[model samples]
Target chain A: MELDGNSSRGKTIASGVIPFVFVIILMLYIFGPGSDLLDLGIPLPEITIEKIDFVDSEIQATVRNTGPISVEVVMADVNDRIQPAAVEPDKSLERFETALVRIPFEWNAGEPYTIGITIDDGTRFEKEIDAAAPALDFSLDLVVFFAIIGTYVGVIPIMIGLLWLPFIKKISRKKYHFFLALTAGLLLFLAIDSIEEAIDVSDENLAGSFNGTLLVVTIVILSFLVLYYAGEKLVKQANSSKITKHVAIALMISIGIGLHNFGEGLAIGASVGLGSIAFSTFLIVGFALHNTTEGIAIAAPMSRGKLMIGKLVAMGLIAGTPAIFGAWLGGFSYSPFSTVIFLSIGAGAIFQVILVLVKWIKEQDTVLSSGAVVSGFATGISIMYLTSILV
Target chain B: MMILVLSVIVGLSVIAILPVMSEAQLKQKTFVTHSGSVIQTTGEIIDPLYTVSSVEFDPEEFLRNFEYGRISVSESGQTIRDYTIIAEDDKIQEISPGVFFNIWSFNGTVPGPTIRATEGDLVRINFINNGSKEHTMHFHGIHPAEMDGVFESVGSGGGQFVYEFEAGPVGVHPYHCHVMPLEEHIVHGLYGVFIVDPKEERPPADEMVMVLNGFDTDFDTENNFYAANTIPFYYQHHPIQINTDELIRIYVVNMVEFDPINNFHLHGNLYKYYPTGTDLIPSFYTDMITLSQTERGIMEFEYKFPGKYLFHAHKVEFSEKGWVGMFLVNDNHEKNNQEIENGT
Candidate 1:
């Protein structure tokens, strides 16, 4: 069927509108702007303290799943005695919540007192602290969470804005090239920034031989390759189907985005698991914003196809599931090696998708000029910078 | 139709004959003394360390001396008997320090009497907690959350409860203190290594039981609470001797207040550490395996050398506090000459 101007216009507007609205809602949820309704008392999850180590200012307990459905621990307040008090508390305490939980509390060097857990759920769990167990040297979990939050909140919006301008607006070829150059510069900056954050995280490692500088570079390269190949294969396969083509492409893009999101979640989980919640919170907000853009990107291709609402939702989920899984996995298992492997694969897939998109734009030879592309790329970079500053 | 009938017949026949074969093998066992003690305090075995430096203790110098033995309990109290346990580093060493009172145990094994029950049969254990502490038995890896003696149902310090659950899977299962934060109770010697024999009869190699018990003690104190009591305050270290090429099954139980991450390294033998104590996964291989508190790991290895092999806690500090022990593997038919090198 030939493409109709009205339908195409409607699809484009809808694709952009849906994600924009979602982003607004997400922002409200994150920033609690414009209303107290956002903080409506949703019965927060409860944590029960089992034991406390007075020497280390650490509390060992089970976070009971007393809620109807499993909830994620977005934040927690620990005592000052904890050496590195930051912790990423993100995990779904399965229904009827009875899981072994251990958290370190920071205490004054020679102080003796009970430790309590002011969980994200708003309930406090405490125990009479024991004078035994060793003190927690540092929590690596929080470091990862903060790094992820930084990248998501600080790096992703600009990327979305960059993609938007060139593709949506009609611009000159030369200007688009300039925009692309700008984007390349911005990406280099982001990559370097991420590496620096990674190095900072590594410095906090009290256990194991993990060098952040080495790890960040390794993750970036690995992520680049995994995303690149996987995206290429997916796009190639989806391109062949005329009937399911649009949906398939959308799904492919979503999957890649989802994987990336999951990696971000892992970073959050690892940080929280290691007791880095403040940093992880930043990561969550950043990721939540970046993910909204990712949602839009996945929907854009399908919107052009004039697909049904069901298909769009399905595609959205295909992209979203990875984030959910990643968030849970990151919170559950805080293993750096595993996180690195996952992040590498995700980065690789994203790299591949971008390449395919660039190639497709070139082949179309449409009225969309190079200048618009350049402008779009620059916008993406500028937005990221602005968000980073604001954050 | 014929194939279905044949399969059914085979299954039924196998079920009928499996328990008979297991009973026959149980009769072939003899009495022996392991390196550790087998006391009658409460109904459970106290301080049942499988491998010790010496079985012969100087009664004069040592305030207390006891031989390694086993206690078997049936529904009736009259069936109780003292079974001698042999200490062999090559063969599996059997030590039950976690089984608390009133539960009928096999030769004083913690996991009450290894009762061979068929799929349709009910394994009834009328156990009593005669020990100074309250204790309860909870089956591990069993479904039906109620029967899984977790939560607050399992009591401690002379507390008694009956656990009746269907025999689902046939494999080696464990039963221990399901009450309290098990890390501390199990570490204080309140667990037992259990086995649910399969319906199929397998070849019998020289069988030995070795229970790996993690202890947290205060050596400076004089107390009879074997759970937190000091390790045998005899000397610096104790050597456990074994023979070469022996097929050994080590039933490792970690009963410590804290999870004792142990790495059981054999000098020259590669061992298979079973995560769930059954369905051995070869790839989950490691010289140093970390056993969580209240968890059990059963490993099988063949010793190749005929010399003094050191098997101690990977946490090097444990040795200075008496966490180090030795294994002497001698050639076949060669009596351990080093046995006399250190006077008993």
Candidate 2:
């Protein structure tokens, strides 16, 4: 059944509104001003830093999860600077329930410092403790945080828009081809940038016997090949079935994109985990925008087919899963090689998908001419290039 | 129609009975290794003399000399009265090949042997330090402060201390030397696994003991600067062979002087991991068990089909060097093949 125009229009508005609201709420929760409610003696869940040891520059502590349900912990150093530590939500909070957490840090000897643990449950628990001089040395940079946020919020949306324009707008075929060419250029640039970064990381290592630079390139190329074939097989299989054809196609495309997005998230997560919060933040924002545009790209064909609203929503979610998974994985595992490999794979798969989309457009005999397609492809590439420069 | 019904009934019966037999076959069994022979013992003190270090524990030596050793218990039968462990420095002593130590440990070697205690039993340990430095026993996989042997509780020059803690949960728990010079003391020799069998009941098995220990050393150096039981090593191997489809539960404890997360990989089996000390929950299925320092994990897997498989730490360096072992599965077919080949 075809989607009614009114319902589709309503959904588009809802989608835009929901994300905007969610982002605002997230910001307020993170940076909002608040007063100390504990002074009033209104008993809330208590979190105590039972022990803190600065062993070899890494801050290790045992946090007692004393609340009813699991809570997210936010830790900051003596300077009130937030420390990036991945503390998984505790599912149970029986009294004195403990979780051992470690954060890579460095401290000056004989300097007394304070650490704050903010439990982000409905009832927040804040504990400040004195930290001893560290036995090791490590530092978290702010650039990573910004990078993560920018990737999710900024770059992602623009990329998504570029992905959709060819199919969504009533443009000339030449414009579409231009958009395709533009996308190709942008992707090629990204791939090169990732390889360079991979080399830089390998170069920083001094203790290994193998040539770090060559190994990084080899792995990146291998990852790209593996992801490319995997994506192609997925698309082919999706198209094989008549009964489950559209759904299958949607899923396959989503998986490829998801894998790619996960790599981006890993990059963001790794940066933040290592105390590069600013960089991580920028990455998150860019990836978010890119993913939204990706959703549009996937939805445009389904929209043309005039599928039901529920099916469309389901397809959107499926496509979005990879980005979400990517965000989480990026935050957890901190490995430069892993991040580079995943990003390259994502770039490759997206390149293949765009190719398939162009082919599909060519086979269709519509009033929209080939010139519009070319122009559209070029536009996609140019926009990405302009944005990459800004980033 | 009658023939079809009979065949269906028979098929269903076979399917139903197979798992029960398999479960019976997989029950935990005890195997004792001594001198140069492997014996299946029922109820006697099977290889009593053992070695406990900071990183690993061997119960085979203790099992062999069980009759001579004294297992003192409290009057209530809940606590150990005089559980003595002597730590001393010695030359290369042999209990088995590739297992030699410059350190002669109480219960006899590194990771003093397995101490079997029932549920709710109180274990009192008396540790004698004959080594150059001080040391204390820390029981891992148990509850907080009460049994956690950290801080300056025991030390050198034949000092005696009593550790009283009620044991809860049933599974293989590990105890090690927790004292200053932690790395040197442990590497020299100190650690072993303690098994707390289920209070209710458990199945029987042809049990074999395997412990994975982490040690760090400058392999290039020839001087005995080797802190054997101390730092996390790149590799150490322990091999075992079992019948096809045998149920195996490996109790793994991390006692590295430095906290090193290891990925335990089994070559041909996917292990179902139980996160907590013992009560089995739906496993987080994976080949590698990521173990943190002082953490204990119990992993179970059935070698359903027969084949020789390798299981070891997936940290490539560990497997290539020495932290490696093999699992040989001998099913009916393989046994038959071997017998034919041997002309026996």
The Cα RMSD in angstroms, rounded to one decimal, for candidate 2 relative to the true structure is 29.1
lDDT of 1 at A224: 71
Task: List residue ranges in candidate 2 displaced over 4 A.
Answer: A1-391, B1-82, B90-106, B141-148, B219-239, B257-259, B332-344
What RMSD does each model have against the real structure?
28.0, 29.1
* Cα-based TM-score, every candidate: 0.31, 0.34
Best by TM-score: 2
Looking at model 2, give its docking quality level.
incorrect
List model 2 lDDT by residue over A91-154, tens digit each.
Answer: 2335556655454456655455555454433122233333354322232332344344534543
lDDT of 1 at B197: 41
- Candidate 1 local lDDT, A86-143, one digit each (tens): 2223244555544433343344433345544433322344444323334233446634
Chain A only TM-scores, each candidate in turn: 0.49, 0.49
